[model samples]
Target: MEQAFSGRRVLVVDDNADAAELVGEVMSLHGHDVVVAHGGKAALAAAATFLPDVVFLDIGMPDMDGYEVACALRRDPSFDTARIVALTAWGDLASRARAVACGFDGHLVKPAMLDSLINEAALAR
Candidate 1:
C-alpha cells in the first residue's frame, strides 16, 4: 500500500492572483498549510519564512520566472529537501526539460487536477 501524508507546508506561486489563490485554497481544504505568493519575489520572501515542504511554482511570471526561483531555492540549504514542482501552462517537452534542469522535482501543467495536487504534496519530504 502507498503511504499517506498530511498537514504539509505548501507554497503556491503564480503571478495570476486567481490561480495562486485557487491552488492555495485547494491545498488548505485538503489539510495542508498553504501560502500564496503572487510573484516570484514574494515567493522567495514567503519561502524564507514559510520554509515550505512543497512548492507549486508558475513558470511565466514577469518579474522572475519559476526556473529562476527554483534555482534560487535549490541554492538555499533549507530547501534541499523540499519538493519544487513547476505548475505552469507550459506543458511542452522543452519546458518540461527546462523545469527538470532547473531543479524541479515534478512538473504539472496548468489547471492541474485537484487530486494530482494533493498527491504531489503528499510526496513531499
Candidate 2:
C-alpha cells in the first residue's frame, strides 16, 4: 500500500539554490508544506515564521553554515521538538560528530534518494 504522509512543515536550506528548490518541490509533492532557504541566514529567518517540523540543512553554506544554523534553531524554545537533519555531501566521521554536537536529530547524505527522503521526512509527521 502507498503510505500517505500528511502535510508537515519542512525547511530545505542549501547554498545550492536549485538543489534546495528541487528537494522542496519533492517534499511538497509528498504532502509536506516545504520552504526553501538559499543560505543559513535565510534559513534562520524562515524558521522564525515558518516554524518547521524538520530542517534539511546543507552544512557548507557561506555565511552561517548549517551547524551554526542548527545550533541557533536549537536555542530557540519554539524548535525544541523540531528535527534537525544534516543534508550534506560530507558523511565523514568528523562531519557526523559536528552535526551531533550542533544538536541535529539525524543525518542524510546529499543527492538524497526519493524514497529515503520521504521516509526521513515522514518522521516529522
**lDDT of candidate model 2 versus the reference:** 0.89
lDDT per residue as tens, model 2, 23-83: 9998888888999999999999999999998899999988999999999999999999898
Worst 10 residues of 2 by lDDT: 1-10
Candidates in order have lDDT scores of 0.93, 0.89
| Best of the candidates, TM-score | 1
lDDT tens digits by residue: candidate 1, 24-99: 9988888888999999999999999999999999999999999999999999999999999999999999999999
What clash pairs does model 2 have? none
Root-mean-square deviation of every model? 2.2, 1.5
After the best TM-score superposition of candidate 1, give how far the Cα of residue 78 lies from its true spot, in angstroms: 0.4
Error of 1 at 108 (Å): 0.7
- Judged by lDDT, which candidate is best? 1
